[model samples]
Target: MGVIKHQSIRSTLLIYIGFAIGAVNIVFLFPRFFSDTQFALTRLLPEIAIILVPICTLSTVPAISRFFPYYASHLKDKENDMLTLALGATIIGFSLFVLGTLFFKDAIIKANIEKSPLFITYFYLLYPNVFLFSVFGVFESYSGSRHLTVFPNFLKELVLRLLTTVLIVLHYLSWINFDTFLWLFSLLYGVLLLALLVYLRRHKFLYFNFRISRVTRRLLPKMATYSLSLLGASLFTLLANNLAPLILTSSKGLQDVAYLTIAQYMSQLIMVPQRSISAIGLPVLAQAWKDKDKDKIEEVYVKSSLLQLTYALFVFLIIWSNIDSFFQLLPPNYSVGKYVVLCLGISKVIDMGTGLNSQVLSTSRLWRYDLYSSVVLLALSLPLNYYLINHFGLIGTGYATLLSMLVFNTIRYIFIWVKFGLQPFTMSSVKAIGVALVAYFGCIWIPLAIHPFVDIVIRGILFLAIFVTLVLAFRVSGDITSTIYSAVNKIRRRQ
Candidate 1:
């Protein structure tokens, strides 16, 4: 918990910094510099590749965390075959993907040509985008396994986004055409991969042990089984999540894709704490399971729930409270995504409230259930997406995602509680909900300022004051209070 707390906070701060820069990029720069269709291409390309990353890496993202404890405790880094097998699987998987894409190239074009021609114009660029993304995914997981996540996160969340800002600016200035811009955009992942590689190599945590050691040979069978099963889980879940974007691009065209992308981005702003916490959580759970420390795992589960929910609700309120103002900062067309933001934002808060159920389940002995959960999500979400999107359009996509996530998290919660006697709620959970409601209602009727920025400042500060004060007074999380007090003490000592 100590390391998780320290690193998670650092990583969370870094993620927030990235989000700040990224907000400017997505909300301001891209929209100003590119057309809706071109912006959709930028968004959709990454969507396609993110879906491909897990399969291309053979689900080594989770497998690396799951198996790293064993490999590290038993074998030296030079002899550790975990990374070797991970990279090998990625190479093979990516090769097959390329072959398949080439074979079906005409079919893919046929599907998107009429609706999303801009997407298809740059379709081949997905190869570089997904491959580099896949490689980075594997390395990032390995870095997290070593509990040295802050630096990798800095490169990923902060540095990459900062560089992206430069790329978009270059295009905006007419220094590079869109073609070259897209090419460089795809290659940014390559730069990110190279940076992480250098970091891992310097830290002595990365080496290609293609020569399978005795220990690795013994573990290969289990690792193989784990990776393949998790791959099914990863693929199904990603596909289900993207069903809206895929259907929109094919049916409604890039215009809707643009709206959905922006809405999704807005909703993701609430995910920083959850994202930061979960990144370091897997390795901790893996080691806990290794030592048979059920208590430690349970403690992490409950604390993560409280801490994540506390911030999740806090951020969710801040965003929703200022959503109108935030949208005002964007072009008028993007305002259509208001409902999408609401649906996804509420859904995200619900998932964060459930804590790290999925993370713990993946690292537990009940990992096979992780696959089952994804299958369930796919089954529920596919029909929901088709039905709702047919009826509601882009906002329908948000509703579909929200409902699917609701059921998905419910199922995982049930599974974890039934199997492991572990649930992530405490008394603080209820209090966190109370805090959010109070802050929201307390601020909702406040009239908007003439300027959106001024409205945001006024609303954000009022909400923060009410929320943080109540949270600390209620001791919604001792962790939160202690951290605040610790910071205050440091300030006092410096003064």
Candidate 2:
């Protein structure tokens, strides 16, 4: 928990910084610079790659966290065949990925041409995008297995966003046209992959050890079984999360997809804390299981839940409360995504409240449950997406995602509780909910000014005052209060 907390704080700072850069890109730069179709292409490319990453990496992402402990603990000098297995699987997966993309090219183009014809022009870009991200995921997970979490977060969050901003700015200045801009955008992942490779080499974690002869054939079966199951789980989860963009691009036009992308971006901002904590905590969960330290794992689980819930509620309220003002800062066409923001924001809150449930499960002995849950999520979400998008338009896709995540998290939560006797809720959980509601309602009566910025600042301050005061008074989380108090004391001493 200590290490998780320390790394998570640093990672959170980096992620938020990245989010700041991304907010500028998504809110101001893209809308102001690129046309709607171009903007949708930018967002959709990543979404497509995201949906492909699981299979492209052959589930190496979770495999590293789940199985690395066993290999390192048993093998000499903390060495194992994990990387060799992962990389080998990835090469084969990449081959298949290329073949599959080529085979499905016509179908994909035909499907999107009606509504998002511009996508066909850049369709080949998806292959490279998927390949680069697959390599990145493999290395990132390996780095995480070594407990080198913060750097990967920096690479993904800050460094990548920084690069994206540069490219977008270049595009804005007419230094590069749309095709070059889009290609460079995909290459950002390649740059990050190179950075990660350098990091791994510096740390001497980059050595490749097949170790086929050392480990008995018996262990091979276990490894294969685990990887296959996790691959299914990872694939399903990715599809569920990233499929909305594709569905939107199909049912609605690319412009509507652009709108949904903005809403999704704003909603994802609330997930910084959860993402940071989970990134650092997965390996910790794995180690705890290795040590048979159920108490430590439970501590991590509960603390993560409480902390994320508090942060999630705070961010959601702040964003939603000022959502109108935030949208006003964007172009008028983006206003159509206001409801999308609400739906996705609420869904992210639900995701946060579930804490590190999925991480804990994936790294624990009950990891197989993740496969089942993900299968259910995919099965439920695809049809829901089809039906909802047909009936309700763009925002319906957001609703589909919201409902999918709700069910997905609920299933994970129940399984954790029943199997491990672990749950994230405490008396403080109830108090945190109360605090959020009070702050929301109490600040609702504030008058809106003519200037959206002024209204946002004033209303944000009032909401923060009410929310933080009640949370501290009620001691919703001792960790949060102590940190605040400690910072305050440092300031006082300096004064």
Per-residue CA lDDT of model 2 for 1-495, tens digit only, reads 777777888898899999999888888888889899999999888888887887877777787887777777677643567777788888888899889878988898889899999998888888789888888888888888888989999999999988999998898889999889988998899889888999989988888765663552546676677788988998898888877788878878888888888888888888999888887889889889989999989999999999899999988998888888998898887898898889899999999998898888888887899899999999989999889989998888888989998999999999999999999899999999999989988887888899998999988899999998998999998888877788799999999
In lDDT terms, how accurate is model 1?
0.89
Error of 2 at 356 (Å): 1.4
Flag clash pairs in model 1.
none
What lDDT does each candidate get?
0.89, 0.86
Could you estimate the TM-score for every candidate? 0.98, 0.96
Pull out the clashing pairs in model 2.
none
What lDDT is reached at residue 244 by model 2? 78
- Candidate 2 ranges beyond 4 A from true positions: 77-79, 213-218, 492-495
The CA lDDT at 46 in model 2 is 81
Expressed as tens digits, the lDDT of each residue in 446-465 for candidate 1 is 99899999999999999999
